[model samples]
Every structure is written in structure tokens, then in C-alpha cells.
Target: MTARERLRDYHAKRDFGRTGEPRGRGAAVGDEPRFVVQIHDASTLHFDFRLQVGDVLKSWSVPKGPSGDPRDKRLAVPTEDHPLEYEEYEGVIPAGEYGGGTVIVWDHGTFEPLSHDRKGRPVDFAESLDHGHATFRLHGEKLRGEYALTRFRTGKDESWLLVKGSADHARRQGTPDPRRARSVHSGRTLAQVAGNS
Candidate 1:
């Protein structure tokens, strides 16, 4: 499906008139692939993990955010494809709107596909995703090192598992707690970004 068609579900759920989020219309981006982890304080706090695939941002709602521990397999629920400009979105979504609450750009940067085929040949990222698995390395500010997203189940909505690479390389450094972490883009906490602080 085309990227614009892929965003149909996303647009259907949200009321642009009630939220400040950008409409998933034409978004100009560079050739480099991009990734973003958005801290969304909705009814419940969760991280919106997004990777630029094709012309839209393939998204997953990670409940526990991402960990620096390989043993920590975070649950990632597949969400709708978002626009590329959504990477810069950091504000409050009106109360009656879908996913209404504060949003912050937690981490964002370029990513490289780390998936390979049986013969150790590099596999296309889209192909890897189609096969229900994708391995990639993130070079974001708050998050670094390798990470993998594997579809563990398929039902009403798809569910995936987000895991870090190795324990040694997964160890987090400064600002160990993600809840207390500030936005890499604005240096503001969720509360501050929401204008509640």
C-alpha cells in the first residue's frame, strides 16, 4: 500500500480540529532513514516508537518505553503510520481528542538496518518487517546501540517485542530513569512540555 493509504487508520482516529498535531499530508524528508521515540502521556503513559519506512513513519506504542537491558522485552503494540513531520511534535493534545495528553520528542536520530538473511546477506528493511521481524541500530541522543522489533503475535491488532542488543552495550549511562528524563529536542520534561510546570 502507498504511504498515504497507510495513514488512513491514523487520520480516521484523530480529529485535527481538536489537536495541534500536523495532518499526515505531504511531508518532505531526506533520503536518510529516521527514527523517533516519543513519550506520550495519554490515559496511560507510553512511548510511541516510530521508524521512517517508505514515505510514512511506521509506529508502535511501547508501554514500558525502551530499556538498556537485553533481558527487558518491552511490549510494543502496532499503531498507525504517522507523518514524517510528527517527529517534531511536542505539545498537548486536547482532552476530547484521540491520544489526548502531552507529547514529547524523547529521542530521535538516523538508524541503519541490521537485519540479514540466512546466507548473511543484508535484507531490506521493508522485507524484514513483512516477515514479522526487524533488527536495527539506533543512534539517537538518549538511546544508542542496537535494537530489535519482533512481531510476537497477530490478532485484532498486531503486537511486537522490543529488545535491546547485549547487556554490556545496553547499559544506560546518564539520566538512568526515563520517567525523569527530559526531552532531547526541547530539554523539557513531560510536565514542562505540557505547560503544567
Candidate 2:
């Protein structure tokens, strides 16, 4: 399906007139696919992990945020697809909105799809994701090296795991305190963003 079709649910959940969130005018794809991790201080504070798939961003709600440590297995719950423009979003979502809260662009950068078939042939990143697993290397300002997202459940209880690969790029450090994390775009924390709004 096209990006427009994939974003229907996202659009339905949001009222463009009231929210500052983008209406998702399809953007031109760049040479490399992008990934972003946004800290969302919603009713339940969490991280939103998004990967560019086709023209939209396939997203997930990561409760504990992403970690640099290889041993950290972060639970990731799938969410509606988002617009490419959302990568730059950093502000407060109004109260009573679908996701009313403060938001900050925690990290974002290009990524290299590393999924391969049993024969070692490069597989399409979207296809790999559809099959419940995908591996990629992130080149973000704060997050680098290899990572993987693997779906562990499906249907109503669907969930996935985001784990840092145990490669040379893996770090001994894990995720920082979400309240203390600053936006890569604005250098503001959730409290600061909310305070300004």
C-alpha cells in the first residue's frame, strides 16, 4: 500500500486543525532510510521508535526507551504509521488530543538495512519486517552500530523487541533516564518543552 493509505489511521486519530502534528504530505525518499527515537511524555511516558519504510514511518511505542547495551531487550509495541516530517517534531501535544503530551526528538539518523536471506542475499527491509524480524545499522548522533527488531507476538497482543546487536559497536552503557534525555533537534527535555508551550 502507498504511504497515503498507510497513514489513514494516523490521520483519523488526529485533528489537523487542533494539533501541530504534520498531515503527512508524502515526502521524497532520500538515499538512505532514516530512523528516529522520540521521547513522548504522554499519559505514560515512553519512547517512540520509528523507521522509514517506503514513504511512511513504521513506528513503535518503546516503554523503557532504546538502550546502547547489547543485553538490553526493550519491549516495543507497534503504533500507527507516522509522516516523515515527524522526525523533526519537538513540542507539546495539546491536552485531550490522541497523544496529549510533550515530545522531543531524542535521536535520529540514517540507517543501513542489514537483513539477508538464508542464501545471504540482501532482503528488502520492509519484507524482513513483515516476516517479523529486521536488522539494521543505525548511524545517529547518539545511537550507532547494529540493532534488530523482532516481533515476538501477533494479533491483539502483538509486541516486539528492540535489541542492540552484540558487535564491536555495542556499548557498555544503557538508556539514560527518560526525564533527563534531551532532544537532538532542540536540546530540550520534556519538562522544558512542556514549560515553553
Across 51-133, the per-residue lDDT of candidate 2 in tens digits comes to 99989999999999889998899999999999999988888889999999999999999999999999999999999999999
Q: Assess candidate 2 and give its TM-score to the true structure.
A: 0.98
Clashing pairs in 2: none
* Best model number under lDDT: 2
Task: Please give the lDDT score at residue 102 for candidate 1.
Answer: 92
| lDDT scores in order | 0.86, 0.93
lDDT of 2 at 172: 84
Error of 2 at 197 (Å): 0.9
Model 1 residue 161 CA deviation in Å: 0.7
